[model samples]
Every structure is written in structure tokens, then in C-alpha cells.
Target: MALIPVDAALERVLEGINPLPAEEIPLHDGMGRVLASPLHALRTQPPFNASAMDGYAVRASDTLDERRDLSVIGEAAAGARFPGSMGQGQAVRIFTGAPVPDGADAVLIQENAESVSDRTIRAAKPVEHGRHIRQAGMDFHAGDLLLEQGRRLDPGALTLAASSGHARLLVHRRPRVAVLATGNELVNPGETTGQDSIVASNSYGIAAIAKEEGAEIIDLGIASDNDQHLSSLFAKARDTAADILVTLGGASVGKHDLVRGALAEAGMELSFWKVAMRPGKPLISGRMGAMHVLGLPGNPVSSLVCAELFLRPLVAHMQGARHEPDMRSAALGAPLRANDERQDYIRAVVRHTAEGMIATPFTRQDSSQLTAYATANCLIIRKPHAPAANTGDDCRILMLHR
Candidate 1:
């Protein structure tokens, strides 16, 4: 049977997904979380008109002469305000962040003034109105919305929230992900490997991807290739209250492919069973009650690729987070053969050239190879039935930094 297109598959998967519930968390621990609602400023910044530098606060009209001498009535430090107004020829000594005196309309830096006596000072240079003065609400005003809903909190966002008098933030809860690996010949990474068994590596990679998408993982370990074992694992995943369940391997139609059967037993509705993509053709997507499930191919490279192509977006949608799809084009470093019926996602090494980005596909195109996938920083895309491509041909590329 033919495979489904990437766009169609993505649309089907995202149709029913919904954002998780909101939770209140401390501001310090809110980084990377999506805000549930708009955040309003509770108080105005610089509650009072203040001086931005250590200097003298005086009326703008008083500094019209070459050297205007003014009597110092009182001093103002940060968090301290001068109670009375200044006279026509008088000034108040002020420090950085101190509230400007009531009658003063300008501030001159101390460098522009020289002390002449105990109560008087002389202007060393010219002065302008509003110089070195921070008016009330200069940064933000009260009742103003500083951040909108669905914004991911970053360093600047956190600082803005703190400035708005928010001790804690309201954000969407992290999506819960359950991982289940299937195969009778699979063994734990730390266990001594049997001649017929391969070490279980897919779970770790999938878990890492899930965490990067802001989802919490609950690992169900490996389930032997049997209906009983698979059923037990499915039940355990449900008990953990997982919002998305990911099953590694056993997605194709084989004697040992018990994932579909088990899902049927668990009352899951199969959405799609395959995609038009190389290495991950056996990918399966389904819904089990309120939770979504993604079945990936057994090969390590294929499994990780499927997780990136499908699972990551599902998790992001559930968290109310926005991410740009991997949509980039680059020049092919070498000639490529005509693509078959399956869409190709060949592992490649992408580098910057004087002209533009250059992508070269690895020699071995097998799905099971892991080392090549590790060294590859990009995935070169080839549509199904695509014609043969030569060097410098334009192709889509997906950059993988992690």
C-alpha cells in the first residue's frame, strides 16, 4: 500500500489535540512554560518622577546663565524624597534613582555642577530640561498588559513579570508522555546482551525528545513480544495518567506485531498506519480514549526520526506552545538518485559554504544504521517519485542541533 503525505498526516494528528490545564508555579521555575493568560502590570514603574543620575535637581529656567549659583535645601538619595519645592535660584542635591523634587523640572549631573559653599553650588556647564530625569511610568504603566497568552517565558519575560509585581506565574501544565518498547529480542542497555538480542536504545532517545518538547516521560521499559506482556504494559501506561503513549517497534504487520492488536483490545481508534517517508514507513498513529499514541519503527535511527517528525509536534500542540515547522531549503552537495514511491529523509551533513548551505547525504541509506545518524546534522528531503538530482540541486533540509 502507498503511504500518506506529511502534511495530511500532521493535520489529522493535530485535529483533536487540546492544550493541557493551567497551573500556578513560582516565577523562578516558570522558564519555557506557556503563559495561560495575559499578565498586567500591577504598579507603574518609577512610581514617582525620579533622577536617573547623582546630580542637582533644579528648575530648567534657573540654568540660563554661565554659572547659576543655587542654595541646597535638602539631599535626596534612592528611596528618599525631598519634601519641599525648590526656590527660583535654589537646587536640591540628588542621587541616582532619587525622586525629583516637586518644583524641579530638570536634573544636571554632578559633573556639570561645582560646590561653592555649604548651601550653594555653581553650574559648570549648560543644562536641559528633563535631562537625567526618569518620568513616572517610563518603563511600564499600571494595568498595561506586559505579556500575552501562549508566550513562552524567557529571561526577559521573567524580568518583566517580576517588574509587574508577579510573585508566581500561571502557565500550562507539562504534558505527560508514556514510553513502551516492544520486541522479544530487546534487552536493557546495562544488561549483558544475548546473542539474539539488541540493546534497547529507542526509549532513551524518545524520552530525550519528549523532555525537550516540555513533556514529562513515564518509561514502561521493554515488553516481550507477546499479547500478555503488551497488554500489561498498556495498562501500566494508563495507570500513570499519560496524555500521550509512544510504542517503539511492532507497528508493522508481522507475526510479532502486537501493538495494533493490543491497542484494539484497549479500545483505540487507528488514525493512520503509515507515512510517505523513508526509514519510518511503519509509523502508526492512533487515539486511545483521551490519550494519543504514536507507534514508531524498531530501528533506532528510524524511531528517533519518527519522534522528531510526529511526536514533537503533538507534544507542543498539547502544551499550547508554538514552533515553526522544519521548512528550509539548501543546495545538494552531490548528485542523488531518483526517489522511489516512499518520500526520502536521508541523513546528511550540512555545512555553510560561501554561496549557501550545502547538504551531502551519507553513503549508507539503511534505516537500522545509528552511527551515521549521530554524525549527521541534517536530513535532506526528497519527495516521492522525485526525478534524479545532480550537484547543486535545491533540496529541503531539517537541521538537528541536539
Candidate 2:
């Protein structure tokens, strides 16, 4: 098969995909979850005219003069309303969030009033109508549309929903991803390693990405190159009912690279393989039943790059989120050479300069260099077959960090 372009490969990876079913969860657990349906206010906020400050609720006409004395008729505290209505030259001592007493059109702040006696107070300054009062439904009215579908419930959103009388919210279920690492030459971290063995580090990074993108992860540990062992791991993924199965290594066509063959044997209908992208060219994607499978390269940098480009978006999409890569324009901080057919994502350090953002690509871009990838804050994108450029030329980059 011909090498698929980067954009085309991403399109194929997301084709026919839809968000998972919605689930109702408590408001406390709704943060970062996407709304599955529009949120309508169940009850009006400030259901009644209420005080916005600790003051005396009086008729605007009663306190219009520079100096006026009014009888203190009643007191209204939060959650308690004064039963009697105010008469002419009458006022009610009110606290913040307290309901405005009947027949009171304004609140005279205590700062501008002086207590004349236990039952009377003198307004030292004129008061305007509706001053220091929150009108009924000021924040939101019952049945008003507060949050739209697909909105992520951040802190503010959760507070709004709660104040609108919502104890529960309908949100998209978190996507469950199963991660499997394959390599006979790999051993778990913290384990004593032989001279020829290296630690399996890719799965932990992949799992972190999945978690940050709102996916619950099931780590399937390590699977050797043996077909039976790979098959057992695939069975575990199926049993977990994972939305996506991510294989950390064994994607290339090498003799020991058995991930693709094992997934095929496990009944994955291959979508596409070998994208036209450097460092991640051997990426593999397919599906078996409802579970999607992605085979990433063994190299640490390549595995992480592929995960950033593909896995994050997939998980966000499954959660009914609107995911877009943070692509930005920058000036080249160094000279570059012409590119080949495969597109290049050069790891770079991005800094804000007086001119603009400057992206300086690392000197060595070997796929196995994890330290450089960890230190870089951005990926400078070079299109396939692009011409050479000098320092200070315009370029596009994908920001990896804030």
C-alpha cells in the first residue's frame, strides 16, 4: 500500500467514530467530563428578590432624602423571609442573600445609615431604587439554557449547574483504553536488567497521556514476541471491553516485530499502516469488533510522538470533546535542509522573543533520543518535499506544553 499522508492517516484513524454513550453522574464527579445534553436551569437562581449586601431594606421613596428616619419593622436573614410587608417610613434589617422584604424597593447600606434607636435608623445618604438588591432570576431563570451539549464541565460550569439546582449531570462516559507493551528484550522498570535487556518505559508514558485525555487506562503489562503470549494479551484487552487497544512496540516489519501479525491473527481489520511521517512511519491502526487498535513504534520518542498526534485526539473524541491541536506560527531559530517524502516533526525548544515565538530544532533528531523529546516544548512541522530554509524563516509548530 502507498504511504498515507499525515492528514489522511489522521482522518482514517477517526473515520466513522462517534462519542460513547452518555452516563448520569453526580455533580461532584462531573468536572472535566463533556456534557452529553444541554443543561437547563431547574430552578431560578435568587428565586426571590434578595439582598446583595448587609443593609436595611427600605422603600426607595422612604430613603430618598439626604436625612430620613424609618422604623425598623423586621429582620430578614438568609433562608428566612420577613412575613410582614413594609409600611411607609418602614425598613427591614437584611443580611446578604436574604430575601428583600415585601414592599421594599431598595437596600440602604448600613455604612450610609446610623442607628437612631433599637427600632429606628436614619439614612445618612439618598438611596436609589434597586440598589444593593439582586432581583429575582437575576442570574438565571428556570428552564433557561445554561450549558450547551458537548461543553466540558470545568469548575465554573459545575458551580453554575449546582446553583441552578442540578444535583446530577449527564456526561459522556470516560473512554477506557487498554495499553500493551510487546518486546522480549524489555523488562519492567525497577527490575534487574540483563546486559541485553532494556526497561519497558513506553507504556507508562502512553498510560499518562490516556489519563490526561480523560481515558481510563488498563495496563496489560509486557508481552513477549511469542504469538501465544501476544494472543493472551489481546484476549485480556478484549475481556476488559476497552475502547482502544494501544500496543507500544512491534509495529515495524522486522522479524521480531510481531504486533501487527498478532493483531491480524486476533481479527483486527487493518485500516492503514506506514504513514508518510518520519519517526512514526510504521504506525498501525485497525479494529476488531468495537475495539480499535493502534500499534506504535518501539522507540521512545517515536511512540510519544505518535501518541500525541493520534491517541490524545481519539480519547477526547470518544468523550464527546472538541479536540484541536495547538498549532502555532513561529520564526525558525536555526537553518534547515530540504525534506524528503516523509513529513518531519522536529523536536524543538520554543521561546518567546521580542520579535515573536522562535522555534529552535534540536541538533540530533534520532528516533531513540527520549531526553531531547522530554526537553523540547514544541514540534516544528516540516511538510513533505519542502525546500531548504534559512534562520528567521516562517514556520509552523505544534506546541507540546503550555
Candidate 3:
């Protein structure tokens, strides 16, 4: 098959995808979850005109003149109301969040009033009507649409939902991903192996990426470069009912690479393979029943880059959340040679400079160098068959997680 472009491959992977079913959960646990439907206010906030500060609720006409004295009739605290209405020259001591007494149109702050006696207080300053009074439905009203569908519940959103009288919320379910690592020369971390064996490390990083995208992960452990092991792992992934199945390594065409063959034998329908990109060209994608399958290269850096480019968005899409990479423009900090047929995502150190953003790519971009990938903060994008460029040339970059 012909090599597919990066954007085209991503479009194919995400075509016809829809968010999962919604489930109702407590408002407290709704944080970081996507709203499945519009949230409306169940009741008006405050429910009535209330005092916004600790003061005296008095008739506006009684406090219009300076040095005015009024008799204290009653007191109103939060969750309590003064039953009697305010008569002429009568005032009520009210606390914040307390309902305003009937016949009271203004609130004279305590700081602006002086106690003349046990029953009388004098207003030292003139008071305006409706001052320091929170009107009914000031924050929100019943049946008001406070939050729209597809919004991710942040701290502010959660507080709003709670204040709007929502004890429960409808949100999209988190996607579940099953991850497996494949290689004959690989061993688990801290395990004894032969001189030629290397420790398997791709599954951990891939799992972390999946988690950051709000996916629940199930590690299927390591699968050797044989049909039996690979088939068994695939069956386990299918039995787990995972939304997406990610396989690390064994994607390229080699004598020992058996992931593609095993997946085919396990009834996987191939979508596309061999994307036209550097360090991740051997990427494969297919479908097995209802589960989506993605085959990543064995090299650590390649696997991570592919995950960021492909898997992250897929997970977000499944959960009804928006996911877009932070792509930015920058100036090349050093000269670069021309590219070949494949596109390149060069790992680089990005820094804010007086001119603008400056991106300096590492000297070596070998896919196996995990240390270099860890140290880089961005990936400078280079298109296929591009010409040589000098320092300070314009470029685009994708910012990575620090």
C-alpha cells in the first residue's frame, strides 16, 4: 500500500466516530468529565432579595437624610427571615445572605451607622435605594441554561452546577484502552535476561499518555514474537471490551515482526499502515469487531510521538471532549538540511526569545533515544521534500508536555 500522509491517516482513524453513552454521576465527581447535555438552573439563586453585607435593613426614605435615627425592630440571620415588615423609622439588623425584610429597600452598612442607644441607630451617611441588596435571581434564574453541552467541567463549572441546585450531572463515560507490548528480545523491568535482551519500556509511557487523555488503561503485559503469544494477547484485549487496543512494536516488515500477521489471523480488518512520517512511518491501524487497534513502532521515542499524534485525540473523541495539539510558530535557532519524501517531527528545545519563539533541534534524532525525547519541549515540523533553511527561518512546532 502507498504511504498515507499524517493528516490523512488521522482523518481516516477518526472518521464516523461518536461519543460513548452518557451516565449520571454525583456533582462532586463531575469534575474533568464532559457534559453530555445542557445543564439548566433548577431554582433561582438566593430565591429572594437578600443582604450582600452585614448591615441594617431600613426603608430608603428613613435613611435619606444624614444623622437620621431609627428604632431596631428585629434581627435576620442567614436561613432566617424577619417576619414583621419595617414601619416608619424602623430598622432590622441583617447579616450577609439574610433575606431582606419586607418594606426595606436599602441596606446601610454597619460601618456607616452609629449606635445611638440599645433600640436606636443613626445613619452617619445618606443611603441610596437598592444599595448592597442582591436582587432575586441575580446570579441565575430557574430554567436558565447555565452550561452548554460538551463543556468540560472545571472547578468553576462544578461550583456553578452545585449552586444551580444540581446534585447529579450527566456526563460522558471515560474511554477504556488496552495496551500490549511485543518483542522476543524484551524483558520486564528489573528481570534477569540474556546479554542481548533489553527491558521493555514502551507500555508504561503509552499508558501514561492514555491516562492523561482521560482513558482507563488495562495492561495486557508482554507478548513474544510468536503467533501463539500474540493471538492470546489479542483475545484477552477483545475479552476485556476495550474501546481501543494499542500494541507496542512489531509493526514494521521484518522476519520476527508478527503483530500484523497475528492481528489478521485474529479477524482484524486492516485500515491503513506505513504513514509518511519520520520515526513513526511503520504505524498500523485496523478494527477488530467493535474495538479499534493501533500498532506502534518498538522504538520508545517513535511510540510516544505516535501516541501523542494519534491516540490522544482518539481517546478524547470517544469521551466527547475537544482535543487539539498546541501548535505554534517559531524561528529556527540553527541551520537545517533538506528533507526527503517523509515528513519529520524533530525533537527540539523551545525557548522564548526577544524576537519570538526559538526552536533548536537536538543533534541526533534517532527514534531509540528516549533521553533526547524526554528533554525536548517541542517538535519542529518539517514537510516532505522541503529545501534547506538557514537560522531564523520561520517554522511551525507542536508543544509537548513538560
| Per-prediction TM-score | 0.91, 0.94, 0.92
Per-model RMSD to reference: 2.4, 1.9, 2.2
Q: Per-residue lDDT tens digits of candidate 1, residues 306-326?
A: 888889888888888776666
lDDT of 2 by residue, 196-304 (tens): 9999999988999889888999989999999999999999999999999999889998999999998999999999999999889999999988999999999999999
Report the Cα lDDT for residue 229, model 2. 98
Better candidate number, 1 or 3, judged by TM-score:
3
Which 10 successive residues of model 3 have the least lDDT summed?
Answer: 59-68
The whole-model lDDT of each prediction reads: 0.89, 0.93, 0.93
Summed backbone clashes in each candidate are 0, 0, 0
lDDT of 3 at 348: 96
The full ranking of all candidates by TM-score, starting with the best, is 2, 3, 1
lDDT of 3 by residue, 1-402 (tens): 899999999998888789988999999898788899999999999699999999999988888777778999999999999998988899999999999999999999999889999989989887899999999999999999999988888999999999999999999998889999999899999999899998999999999999887888999999999999899999998898899999999999999989998999999999999999998999999999999999999999999999999999998888887887999999999889999989999999999978889999999999999999999999999999989988999999999964
- Supply candidate 2's per-residue lDDT for 166: 96
Candidate 3, RMSD to the unseen true structure: 2.2
The per-residue C-alpha lDDT of model 3 at residue 53 equals 94
Task: Tell how far residue 255 is off in model 2, in angstroms.
Answer: 1.8
